[model samples]
Target chain A: MQLNESDLSWRSLPGTLPVRHAVVSREQLLLLCRDVAGRGARLVSLWGEDRRAAGVGYVLVVVLDLTSRLLLTESISRSPNPGFPDLSQLFPSAGRMQRATHDLLGFNFLGADARPWLRHSAWAKDAYPLRHDFVAAAVSAPPLPTEIYPFVRVEGDGAHEIAVGPVHAGTIEPGHFRFSVVGEKVLRLEQQLGYTHKGIEKRFEGLSVQQGSKLAARVSGDSAVAYAWAYAMAVESLTDTQVPARALALRALLLERERLANHLGDLGGIGNDAGLSFGLAQFSRLKEDLLRVNATVWGARYLFDEILPGGVATDLAPTALPILLDSLAAMAAEVAVLQDIYDNHAGLQDRFHGAGVLSAKLARQLGVVGLAARASGQAQDWRAALEIPPYDGFAIGSVLAEGGDVAARVAVRFDEIAESLQVCRGLLTDLPSGEISVAVGKTRADELAVGGIEGWRGPILVGLRVAADGRIARCHPHDPSWLNWPALEHAIIDNIVPDFPLINKSFNLSYSGQDL
Target chain B: MWKILKQIVRTGLVTEPAPNAEPRLLEHALHADIHRLFGRALCIRQVDAGSCNGCELEIHALSNAYYNLEGLGIKFVASPRHADALLVTGPVSKHMADALRRTYEATPEPKLVIAVGDCAACGGVFGEDSYAGLGRIANVIPVDVTVPGCPPTPTALLQGILAALQSPTSRVDKRSASTYQKTEDRG
Candidate 1:
C-alpha cells in the first residue's frame, strides 16, 4: 500500500476483491501515476465513464496491476471542462487508452496524443457515443466518407508506405495496418483498428448483472470462457455471492481447454505462414478433434454461453468425462509428434528462427503479456501469479523463452498447450462434487469491483460498477491485446514485408479484442 | 521429407469422407438449377462486417482436413472480383457498411450472399438500433440465405452456402432494389 501515505486522501472501496480507490484532482493524478510506476505497478487499463446522470460529472478510472493486488484510482472532471493531465508520458501504454477515452467519452488527456483511436468518422465530431446525453438512436445516416488519417510520415530514401486491410485475404477480422518500409525492411508499423467497434461498452449500460455475462463473453470470441468467468467474478464479488467449488473447477477446465484450442490453432497458423502446409492440415485436424470433444462435452464447438454468473450454465456429463480424458490424451500425443516435426523441419526452422524479434527490453517497456510476453522471457502468467482458486491447486508451470522470435512464440504456445492439457486432466481426475451454480444476490449500488483472469492470450481485466437500481452502470473489459499490440509494431521493425504475416501470426493479437 | 512421409503413412488419410448431400426439400428442388449454373466448383469471398471473430473461426474450420471444403470444390478466393458468392458474418457496423456494399458490388453478376451467424442474420445480441451496428446483413446488403447461431457451426455454414447457391434467384425478386435504396439513403 505505497499509495496509502499520499496526501491524495485515498478511500477504500467496498467490494469482495482487494482494491483501493481514490478521487484526486487532475494535477494529483499525474503525481500518483508517476509514484505508482516508480513502485513497479503497471497501468492495466484507463477508461472514462460519464457520470453526469448521477450528478458527478465525468470520472476517469486508472487500474494498476501490482502483481499481488490491484489499485484503482479515479478522478472526476466536471462537464464544463473534462480534461486530465496525461499519464502517458510516464507509462507509454497509457497513450492509446487515453486517446480512446478522448474519442468515446470526449475526455481530453492533455499532453497525450489527441488523435482519435476509436472514432473512425462514424459520427460527427462533437457526438461522443459513451456520454449519457449522447443519443444512440440519432445516428441513422449512412457512414460518411472517412477522412484520410494523417499517418506519421517516414520520409527517407526508399521508405514508401504500404497500407493493408480493413478486409484481409484470409478469414480474419478487419484492421488497417500502415507499414513504412525501406525496400524490403520495415521502418515503422502503424495499426489503425476499431473497424469492429460495435459500441459494446455502451451496450452494457442498464443490463442486469446476469445478462451482462453474455455481452462480456462476446467481447472477444476466442477468450469467451475467460471473459465470462471474469465478468462472473466481478458480479459475484460485487454481490458477495460465493461460487461453488465445483463451478470454480469447471471454469478452470473450460479456461484451459480454451487455451489449448487457441494454441493448437496458432501453432498450425504459424507453421502455415512459414510455408509448411502439412502443419496446417495436421494441427487443424487436431484442433477440430478437440472442438468435437468440446461439442460432445460442453455442447458447443466454441463453448459459447457456457459460463454464467454465480456458476456454470451446464455441468460436465458423467458419460462424457472419460471420453474427454481420452481425447486429451490423444491430442497431447499428437501435439508432441507435431512439435518434433516443427523443430526439425528445415524450411520452417529457417523462416521461424530469427524473425520478428521483440527484445526483453522492448517487451517490458510495452508491458506485453500472454504468450507474446512469455516468448520474450517475461513470466507474467496470472495462473501462477494471481493463484485464484483452481490454478492454485494445479501448480501451473510458467513457460518462458528468451529469443522473442517467431520460433520462441511457437515454442511458448506448444509449452502452454501441453501445460493446459495436464491441468485439464488434473481437474477431471479430482472432479469436485457440489452444486454447479448458486443464486447471486443483488449488487450494491456504486460498488466497483475488478476481475482479472489469465486467458490464453494473457490477463483480461474486467472493471464493473453497479448502478443505483442494481443494474450495470458501466463495464470495461480490457483485453491484453492493448499492451501486446504495440509490441507487434516494434517486433515488425527491421523485418521484411513477407515476414509480417509470420510475425503477426506468431503474436496473433486479436483485432476484435483491441477494437472493442 | 521422409519423416513427414512416415508420419503421413502412419496417419493414413485421416480425412473423413464428404457427407451425403441430403439437401433440405427446398434446397433439393433448386439444387438441379444450381448444379446446371455453377457446375462443380464454387469460389467464395468472405466479408467480416463486425463480428466477434467467432463465426470466422468456424468458417476457417471448414477448410480443415475433416471438413475438407476444398475437397468439395469449394475454395475461398482472395479477391471478391473472382468470387461467385459472398459469405458474410457479424452485424454490419456503421464503419464497415460502405466496405460491405463495395465488396458486394465488386462480385460478378448472379452472385449469392449468405449471412452466417445470429449477428449477421439479425444483429444477434447487439441489435439493430445500436450506435455502431445495423443489426442484420440484409439491412445493409441483399442476403439470399441466412444461417443463424451465436456462431453457426462449420456444417451449418457449409449448408447455408450450398443453399444460397442452389436458390440463386429465389431472394432477388423483392429485396434487390431496396438494398440499393438503403445504401443510397444511408450514403
Candidate 2:
C-alpha cells in the first residue's frame, strides 16, 4: 500500500474487507499508474461509472492486485470533457479495458488506443449505452452493416491474410480472428470478439443487490461458481454479513469441483486438437462422470443458479458425502492412468512441444493471469498467494512449468486437476457442521466493495457499488480472460497457421466473459 | 502403445449401449412420418447464439462414451450445409442474429431447429429486456423445438434433437409447431 504524492487525497473505506480508495486529479492518473506498476502492483480491472446525478461528472475506477491486499483507486473527473490520462502505456493490458470504457461510457482515456473494442458498430458513435441518458429501447432499431473492421495490415513480399469466423465450424462461442501469415508462419494475429455481448453490465444498474448475483453467475457459465461466490462476497462485505464457516467450505468445494471439471474438459480438448481422439474420449468421459456427480449431489450438471447472494442454495445431503467420496476416489484412479498415457505418448509430444510458445518475459509484459500465466512461469495463484479463507488453511501447491508451450499449458491443467482433487477431498472430509446461508439484509447505501476469487481460469474480481437506495449502481465482473486474451495474441506469434487452434484451445480464454 | 492396448483391454467395452431408437408417444405422433422420409442418421450443426457455454458443455457430452450420440446414428457436423438440423443454444445476441440466420439458410431443406437451454427457449435470466440479446432464439430464426433448462441435460438435448428430426415438416414455419406453443405455455 504505497501512495505517491500525485495521489491527491486517499481514504480507507469501512467494509468487511479492507479497501483503500484514492481521489487523483486527471493530470496525476498516468503517473500514479506508473508508480503503482513500479511497486509491483498488477492492474486487475479498469472501468468508468456515470455518476452525473451525484454532481460528479464521471468516475474512473482502477483495481489492482497487490498480492497481500486489493487496491481500488477512484478518480473523479468533473471536467466538462470527462476523461483521464491513459494507463495503457504503463500496463499494456489496460489498452482493451480503456477502449471498452470509452466505447460504453463515452469517457476518453487520453493517449490510449482509441479503437472500438466492444462496441462493434451496434450503436451510433455518439450513443454510449452505459450513460445515464442512454435508453435501452433505442437498441431495437436495425444496426449498421459492420462488414469492414480496420485490422492492422502487414505489407510484405509473401504476406497473406486469413480471416476466421464469428460463426465457427465448432459448437463453440463466436469470435473472429485475422492472421497475417507468410506461408504457414503467422506474422501477426488480431482477435475481434464481442459477438456474445448481452448488455450484462448495463442490466445490473437498477437491480437490487440480491438480484445482482443471478446476473453475475451467467457472466461466464464455466466460472459460474467463481462469479457467484465473488458477487456474494462483495454483497456480504457491503452488508456486513459474516457467512457461516460451513458455507465458506461449501463454496470452496464447489469452486474446486468447477476447476476439476474444466481441467478435464480442456485436457481432452488440447489432446483432441493435437490429433489425439483417444484423449478426447477418455477425458470427456471423466468430465461427464464428474458432472453427473455434481447433478446428483448439487442438482445441476453445470451447477447454474446453485449459489445465491447470501450463501449457496443447496447443501450436501447427510447420506451423499460417502457417495461423493467414493466417486472422487474412482475418478482419481482413472485420471492417474490417463495422466500416464498423456506423458508417455510421443506423437502427442511432437504436436505439443515447442508449439505456440509464450516466453516468461512476454507473459509478464502483457500482465497475463490465471493458469496460462502459471504455465509461462508466473506463479500467481490467488488461492496460494492471497491465502483467503479455506485455502489459507489448506495446502494448495502452485503448479508452474517453464516451457510456456502447449505442453506446459496441458501440464499445468493436469497438475491443477490433481491438486483440486486433494482440496476437494480435504473439504469433504473436514466438512464443518452449520447452516449453509445467512440472511443478508439491506446493503449499506453509497458503499463500494471488491471481491476476488480464484476461479478455474484465474482470478475473477467483482467491483460492486451500491446506490443511495440500496440498488446496484455499478457491478463490473472482470474476468481473467481480459488479462489472458492479449497473452494469446503474443503466444501465437511466429507459430504456424495450423497450430493456431491447438494454441488457442490451450489458452481457451472465454469470449462471453471478455465480451461482457 | 502396448500399455494403451493393455489399458483398453482391461477397461473393455466401457461404452454404454446406444440410446433406444423407439420414439416416444409425442415424438412418434409428430415425427413418425419424417423418420421414414429421411434416413435414420441425422447430421446436426450446433450454433451458440449467446450462451454462457454451459449448454455447450453438455452438448459436447453427447459425444462421450456414456451418451454416445454418434452410436445412435446421430452426429455433429462441422458445416451447416451438411446438417439436417440446427441445434442452437443461448439467447440470440444482436451480433449473432445475422450469423444464426445465415446458418439456417445454409442448412438444406427440411431442416429442423431445436432451441436448447432456458436462454435459447425464453432468454432465461437475460430476458427480452436486454439490449444486446433479442431474448429467445425464435426472435431471430424459426425454432421447431425448445428445450428449457439453465442448461438442458444431454438427455433432454438429445430428445429435443430427436423430436425435431422426427417431426414431419422439414422446416416448420415460425411459431407453428405445437412444441413451440408448449414451450411458451411452460415459460
- Candidate 2 - CAPRI tier? medium
Native contacts kept (model 2) = 0.68
Model 2 spans > 4 angstroms off? A1-18, B14-35, B168-187
TM-score of each predicted structure versus truth: 0.94, 0.94
On residues A194-301, what C-alpha lDDT tens digit does candidate 1 reach at each position? 898888898899898878999999989989999998888888878888889899899999998899889989998889999999999888889999999999888898
DockQ of each candidate, alpha-carbon based = 0.64, 0.57
Candidate 1: segments with Cα more than 4 A from true spot: A1-17, B17-35, B168-187
**RMSD of every prediction:** 4.1, 4.8
Residue B130's lDDT within candidate 1 is: 81
> What TM-score does prediction 1 earn?
0.94
**Model 1 DockQ class:** medium
Instruction: Give lDDT: candidate 1, residue B141.
Output: 88
